[model samples]
Target: MSTIFRASRPAFRARTFFQQNASKTTRRFQSTESTTANAAPESWMQRFWKSEKGPKTVHFWAPMMKWGLVLVGVSDFARPAESLSLTQNAALTTTGIIWTRWCLIIKPKNYLLAAVNFFLGCVGVIQCSRIFMHHQAQKKLAEEVSEAKEAVKEAKDAIKHKSS
Candidate 1:
């Protein structure tokens, strides 16, 4: 009886070991197959647009536009065209504001830069309005001057004809 028990114990251990290994292998295979089966196929457009390179290009161009507008605005400000400068400033400020909002969307917890951008945009708009008003006033003054000059020329021509 002791010899029979010893012989059967080894066989039992081997059987359990094989069963456990088989179960593990089966589970692993099933999980991989299920994941592959469940995954939806990506379209070419989706793959291209969502690729890492696409995001890199957007990030690069957005900042470049924002900074380029700023430089253009600064250089324009030095000239005498206040209205054009103000318009450029407004555009630059808006770009900065949009870029900051985009950054916030990408990283929601950061709000400091966004707030600054918003404030600057507001200031730019106000400045644009003021400059636009001044530009209009200047234009109106020039029109009036031109009309007065035309009236004076007509009066002079009338006097010359009467004297003849």
Candidate 2:
């Protein structure tokens, strides 16, 4: 069979394979070059617009969206410190610190993410400190009230002794 002769001749098959595919490969390689060559140089903004981490991709948008957390924390500024929860703030601070380090180590390095997380940590710490101070003040007031009551009781007993 001619098929057997063809199998025996690998050079003929290889030559035909290359000839058939060469046009397709060349077209792919050169498809966009000519149009781009006549274009003016791109500005930094333009370049960023089309870059891998641009607004079109999730990488940029995720960080932008994450700013909401910081805004929420900031909004709490009008709230009384006594209402703040230490556990919640501590969690935010811990998460912020851990991910801030992770952001720097990731491929391409997300500075926006790092900044947001870092600030998240800051907000958490400030809230925790406020709660701690409030608790401390309340505890001290409680101790003072206890001492005052004890002194009043002792003075009443002394009055009874004098009357007897």
Alpha-carbon RMSD of each model: 18.5, 6.9
lDDT of 2 by residue, 76-110 (tens): 76788888877888888898899899999998888
Which candidate wins on TM-score? 2
Query: What is the TM-score of each predicted model, taking all chains together?
Result: 0.45, 0.75
Clashes per candidate, residues 3 or more apart or on different chains = 0, 0
- Per-residue accuracy of model 1 over 1-164 as CA lDDT, tens digit each: 99988876666445577777887787654553567668899898788577553444554344444444445544554556453666566775676668567667873333444554555565566557667887898999999999999999999999999999
Q: Candidates' lDDT values, in order?
A: 0.64, 0.85
Worst 10 residues of 2 by lDDT: 10-19
